[model samples]
Target: MALFIFRSIPMNTYELDCPAVPFETVGKTVAQVVSRIEQRLRKAELEPEWVVAANWIDDANDSLHGLKADALWPVVVEGESRLCLSVAIGRSEGWLVQIDHVRLHKAGDGGHWSSVALLRIKTLTRTHAWAVAAAMSRLLEID
Candidate 1:
């Protein structure tokens, strides 16, 4: 028999502070964040319970517009995978969602937005979810 080798890798876990993270209802709020999340995942080959939503708001004064901006909206997928989205809502009209940039480092110091393409929701691909998560992490200063 051939020799079989196995190696164990250590994993890093990130936790969220529910009391620290701030969120607000978008639009008329007929549909909650959970509902929107469900819709997004329904098209994927995954179960609803496998997904989790996390929100973040910018605490810095440099936030866009006069209103506080929603910095990061992370959707956990397939257990260890995640799709993080960042959006800013116009005080009067529809929300303007933009992809900031992606970060592969946990330090959250380097990475340029131009390295990643900013695609609209319609043009976004499921294959790019990991990159989106990295971008959101950089935007939120989370790495």
Candidate 2:
């Protein structure tokens, strides 16, 4: 006879917020932030629902040129109830990374998807971007 061992582990969670702890998007716009995170996610195979690049301004060359200097990337987690992981992608000299949770559910039977709720934001840094990106990619991998 063969014996089998089972183990249980807690799911990892992430968050982000303003006055960012590990980083800040002081001069970055939403589009720029999203673009940066988009690249990171794609490289790590953790692509989010969608990514919006800045049309008006591609580079952070002029701080005053960019608009909507804040953005978030929505990632899906395997589960019911439409819960998803959201990262606040900020544009700055150093990238601003904030992780959090949000609920995306349909309004009614045919209504479009909408984010209903959110949890506290936990800020992180570019120094940890690759690590965080890898972990997130694993979490989202399909079996």
lDDT of 2: 0.38
RMSD of each: 17.1, 13.9
What lDDT does the true structure give each of the candidates? 0.32, 0.38
Off by over 4 Å in 1: 1-25, 28-30, 50-143
For model 2, residues 1-143, the per-residue Cα lDDT tens digits are 99999888543333211112322333554555455555555564433434443323444442233222343323444443333444444543333323333334545654443342212122344434433544433333311
* Candidate 1: tens digits of C-alpha lDDT, residues 1-143: 89989898642122122223323322412124334433433443222222222222323442232112232332323433333355444345433333322333333655332122122221133323443333334333334
Q: What is the TM-score of each candidate against the true structure?
A: 0.20, 0.27
lDDT of model 2 at residue 58?
Answer: 42
Model 1, residue 1: what's the lDDT? 88
Q: By TM-score, how accurate is candidate 1?
A: 0.20
**Clashing residue pairs for model 1:** 101-135
C-alpha lDDT of residue 110 in model 1 = 56
